[model samples]
Target: MDLQRQIRNGWFFFLKHIFNPLTRRIARTSFGPFAIVRHVGRRSGKQYETPIIVSPAKDGFVIELTYGPDVDWHKNVLAANGCTVVWHGKEFAVDKPEPLDTETGRAAFPPPQQLVLNLLGRKHFEKLTCKKDE
Candidate 1:
């Protein structure tokens, strides 16, 4: 395998087995920019909670697609048209998952997060609207 693919695979494995478990514990807390996204598998019918960095927007939240838009979690959210986000110790039902322009998505985050994301070469982002009470 090419070195780049090998490295990416290794990093994914590390994140799945080590980083995610440790981060999941605090991602849903009322501090920091971390959040937990609860979604179900599209094919497996299994539930999952993924830790991610979330930035609140005027109407909802902007999520950086660190692994790009084709990632399983993103696909699942799109397929279901929504998911639950645990942020700042509160659960929010979000819907209308859609892709955002690079500039718009980056603008949702603070300067620090934008800098980090830029450094990581992240250009894709998804927006989820807060579900209004009926």
Candidate 2:
């Protein structure tokens, strides 16, 4: 692996295995814009709950790729065709995870969120449309 990927993986290991525990507990209560996306593994057949930061979008939600788009949760969501996201005191079954460019993706966020994304160098984002209730 390249140095950049190695660095990213090291940070990911810390975030997913260590820091996420604290974030998960706080995120579960609907505080902030944190969400728990429940998705199954593509190959392992394991269920995983990944905490992410999201913002309300036109029809669904916009998620910034904090650790970049190569993360496993995003891949899992893509492979599974959808995932359930618990956000802002409600659970939403969202599909159609469309990848967007920095301009379009950042447009979905408020000023504060947009500023943060800019500072973080986040260029890719996903727009997941909420599935309507039957």
Q: What is the C-alpha lDDT of each candidate?
A: 0.87, 0.86
Clashes of 1: 0
Q: Which residue pairs in candidate 2 have backbone atoms (N, alpha carbon, C) closer than 3 angstroms, thus clashing?
A: none
Off by over 4 Å in 1: 1-8
Predicted model with the maximum TM-score = 1
TM of each candidate vs. truth: 0.90, 0.85
Q: What lDDT is reached at residue 47 by model 1?
A: 94
User: What lDDT does model 2 reach?
Assistant: 0.86
Give per-residue CA lDDT, model 2, range 30-125, as digits (tens): 677688899999999999988888888888999887878788888999998999988866789999599888899888888888898889888888
- Encode model 1's per-residue lDDT on 1-134: one tens digit a residue: 99999999999899999999877888766777789999999999799998888899877899987778778988888888899999988899999578889888888999998898888888998798999999
In model 2, which runs have C-alpha deviations exceeding 4 angstroms?
A: 1-13
Candidate 2 residue 121 C-alpha distance from true site, Å: 0.9
